[model samples]
Target: MREVSSDCRVAWFLGLAGLIPFVAGGVIAWWGSSAWQVTAVYGFSYYSAVILSFLGGVHWGSALQVPRPDNRRRLFIAMVPSLIAWPALLFNVVTGLWVLLAGFILIGGYDLSRDGREGFPAWYFKLRGLLTGVVVAFHLIVLLRLGG
Candidate 1:
């Protein structure tokens, strides 16, 4: 493997750091006190929505990186995640979780399918894959905890 630059090292650190809440929320849902379970789920759901929205913004940023009249499609795609997230928040706890889960899968799948061809660095797609996997896993854990 090639030596990763300091920038990559920092990105890796911060990206992994972002997973802390997901891990905590899932663990707490599965094993924390009963009193904390509800709170854990809510926190996890909210955080997931935020992350989903953030993913959309990343696309927006990328689209702006090379602005053009034809980039409107990309910009429209960018808004889809936030649209999904908002409705997910409106649904019941279980349904909302499902919506957010779908949102992650949708966006993550779309990103991965591009295989860094969308102008992002290869390392970014790799990091996104790892982070998305962890995020989805925690979503499953929380859902199962809720008996969904």
Candidate 2:
């Protein structure tokens, strides 16, 4: 088994933290709440993804023992799209759902592919992936119900 490192723990925490906004947004949307409330909730989730991606990059970059410049550059490239998409989705459910679906595919695929090598606790990654998948699915349902 791979040993869990501090960097990996940070990644796990950041990734898991993403669930807060996701759940809040989903609940509001499902309950037929106000648009501003839903948007505000999702906005927090969007920011969480940004934070998680950056943290994940830091974790991976440090694990690889590379320089700061290389690590941050790579991380920025990886996370920028989701950063743009999340807010766009807030404005338009269809666009946001598309962006979020893409994010789910990419993040979930990456996690599954690199499961053991990421240096985090196995359960952490599994739980994170599961929650993200559920949130994405919920949003998709919302999008479909909204007739998008």
In model 1, where do residues sit more than 4 Å from their true spots?
68-70
- In candidate 2, list every pair of residues with a backbone clash: 89-96
Clashes of each: 0, 1
> What's the lDDT of the predicted structure labeled candidate 1?
0.88
lDDT of 1 at 85: 94
lDDT of 2 by residue, 67-141 (tens): 443555445544654565547546555666666566656655655654323445566666666666766776676
Candidate 1 per-residue lDDT, tens place, 1-148, comes to 8989999899999999999999999999988898898888999999999999999999888888966665688788889999999889888889999899999999988787652247688899889989999999999888898888
For each candidate, the alpha-carbon lDDT, in order, equals 0.88, 0.58
Q: After superposition, how far is residue 123 of candidate 2 from its true place, in Å?
A: 3.1
Please report how far candidate 2 places residue 140 from its true position, in Å. Answer: 1.6
